[model samples]
Target chain A: MKPQGIKVLQLMSSRINKYLIISLQIGFLFGFYLVGGYLQKTLALPVPGSVVGMLILLIGLYLKWIPIQWISQGASALLNHLPLLFVPVTVGIMQHLDFFSGKSLWLVPIVLVSTWIVMGATGLLGQFLANRKEWDR
Target chain B: MMLLQMFFWLFITLLLYVVFRRLYQLLPYPFMIPVLTCTVVLVVVLTSFDVSYDTYFSGGQWIDALLGPAIVALAFPLYKQRKLLNKFKVEIFATVVTASLLGILSGYWLAVVSGYNEMIVSTIISKNVTTPVAMEVASMTGGQPAFAVIFVMIAGIGGAVTGPWLFQLLGISNFLGIGMAFGGASHAIGTAKALEYGEREAAISSIGLSLCALCVSLLGPLLLKWIS
Candidate 1:
């Protein structure tokens, strides 16, 4: 009940509040993900649940039902560390070692060339369209 | 006891990833990206110790579980860029759809021509999309989901590493174009690389990545059915 005791209590409460906020933000994200999974299962949608979750969140933002600050910290934290989530899956490649043998020799070249073609085509077309709109102005 | 061991190994995996991520930044090489280095280190350690992936996954699935939430988090960036997206919506959609189609067809044709089997071809065709979507499409098309993931990783990492150089070489200086190319061709990994260019580039890349996934998921099964 002294001044120092009250000050320490306030600091502890503030720290707890910060943790509570982050948990809420993360909960909101996972809530959307669960809803997405439900939709994917019930509706038989072609899209993955995560993409559907993203769309739902985007719509919520657009409708102003969800404030950006509520989720920004949590979302950015996840996005920043996104690649780490993929490490286990990447390591799963070892399971497919047999497939990488003689018959699959062309996998690398095919993937590389296809990616290059897609990139070039998309970039050129997008740039052309943007430039055309500029000239129209 | 099992739960404690799982947590311990998972912690080790995460710690190693953080260390390698820092190393990658300090070294700043394309091949030294955290995911690649972490996977390699873990693989070597696991193999050396004779640990199976199933055991590792028992621990590592916690990180994997976040993939869904991380993807959903993309909405925040997409929301921030809504205005720019609205302005170029039609052009962006068209470019992505066209490029995705091209990517699919080219990969399929090349794989078939190179004497690969139907499953391999089907898997490779969906490699431009994000991992989950690619896996779904692969499953639907009778392709191996694991193979699809491998191909997707190759596409993503290759695109991320080469995208900037390729764009410069082609004289495509527009941020929108660069972002689209990276996203449409490489998916999430390329989008991450695009972030290095700037926020605008990253935003557009996110759009590109999502749109590419949408197109591939909707069209992939139909295309496979038609091809077969």
Candidate 2:
């Protein structure tokens, strides 16, 4: 092939891959929203659309309609930003401190310390179970 | 001044994200540290400025709205890790359930001794679970749902930060054990952290966290009510 033709082909392939990735992330995000919405609307279930979307996506993967690598890149990028995503929520939590005034001020430390223990202990339990015999891989 | 305040918050948030991304690129242990650091910085800044939680929350809620999308996006990792998940479904469930029970009891007991009221105690009881599910548990048990959000975030952040290290400390050599524990303790945030290790781990963690949350939300409250 001519040099010019080779350069053009390379550019095209790179552009295509970039677009492909962008589409996949958008597709996953949108699919989550759609499934969440449809389920809530149809079933009148209390679960959020996002949660439902997650379940649907899980099924999609198990069914083999989508490949891992295809979704992994976009998902990881989002996961990395997971903490950032909650920044606003944390702020909101702080802002709502007034609601906890009076008898509620006592709730803060209790909630924080208790939650920490619960979260930590649960993590440990999961580890223990995984260590057991019948469950051992 | 108000507009400027809002601008600074947004600017700081984005800047922190960039800094975190860069740090992750440079550091071996990237994910947990960035999250913890960002949280601390936020607390300091908010307190220093005497920023009312309500004011900050109004601005922060804009960001909070995105959490749903981010969580739903987790499906991708679950998809990627399907093969491993299929092979280990039962084990994941057992571990997650046990973890969920322990997490709820320890958290509530600690909070009670610490002098928190009934509402606060109930809220923390299901803090590691998702907001919707947690809310259900809260209302059923006469806990406050609004406050449950705070408990949930704290629990999740705590789980995400300490989960991996704890596993290493415990000499947990198994992937299913590590992943399931993360889910049961941290919910989506922990699962997000797990996804970094591998797709299978993330998928299993997500499933474990969600299922445990569902069970706790439904059954936990009923148990509480019955006992009371």
Candidate 3:
């Protein structure tokens, strides 16, 4: 009933609200994953369930069905920790060390050169188009 | 009981990852990427202790499970930048398509010319996109998803490492171009690096990454079929 007691009650309520929003965001994400998995299994789509889940979330946001504030906090938290999730797969690369042997020696060079080509081509092409409008103006 | 042991060991791995990640940030070397460093450390520790990848993955798979949620979360950032998407919609689409096509052709032809198997060629074809999409494309095209992951990581990490410098060397100073190049070529890791430049670069990078994935998913199968 006192001022301190009221303040404590407000803080607890706000904390609970924060946790509630996070749970809802995660629930939505998991729901999409389930839908994607179902589609993949039943339809035999080539797309991965995760990619389908991503599209579902994107459509939710675009259609205004999902509030930004509802998902932003949990979403950003997941994105911030994204690299950590990939560590297992990256480490899993160690399991296939033999794939790099013999003729596969070209694999590294091919990946490196293609990356450079893509970067250069995209940069140059984008810059040219971006500047073309300016020059025309 | 076995599950408990797996959880305990994975917890240790995660703890070591955090410590090493912080340590890598404090170091000055560009090659000292946190993920790569943490991976090397975990692999060494596991190998030293004779822990098989399967045992480690028993618990590690829990962390990997979050990847789907993390990807879905990307929609938030993409949503925030919707205005930018509208502004540069045509240019973004154009650049991504061109770059993705270039990447696929270069990767595929080189692999073929090098006399690698069809599987290797297919894996290399999807290296320009993020891991999940890349793996899917690889599998759809009859390649090994594990091999695709390796190729994707190499492309992503290599692009993140050298992207800015390469752009500068090529005399391209436009942030749009740099961001697009990073996203189209390197995927998520490159986009993460691009975020350091500013919000605009990050937004454009996300666009590039997504468009790259879309193009690969749609065109990759057709291209492989035509080539065969």
Give the per-residue lDDT digits (tens) of candidate 1, residues B1-228.
779868976898899888987997899867777777888888888888887888888888888888788788988888998888898888888888987898889888889888888889889889999998899889888899988888998898888777877887899988778889988999988877777777777788888888889898888878877876
The CA-based lDDT of model 2 is what? 0.68
lDDT of 3 at B61: 87
Q: What's the DockQ of model 2?
A: 0.42
Docking class of 3: medium
lDDT of 1: 0.85
lDDT-best of 1 and 2: 1
RMSD of each: 2.6, 4.4, 3.0
Best by DockQ: 1
In model 3, the clashing pairs are: none
Model 3 TM-score (2 dp) = 0.87
Query: Over 4 Å off in model 1, which ranges?
Result: A1-19, B225-228
Give model 1's TM-score versus the native structure.
0.91
- lDDT values of the candidates? 0.85, 0.68, 0.82
Cα lDDT of candidate 3 equals 0.82
Per-residue lDDT over B189-221 for candidate 3, one digit per residue giving the tens place of the 0 to 100 score: 887777667767777887788778889888988
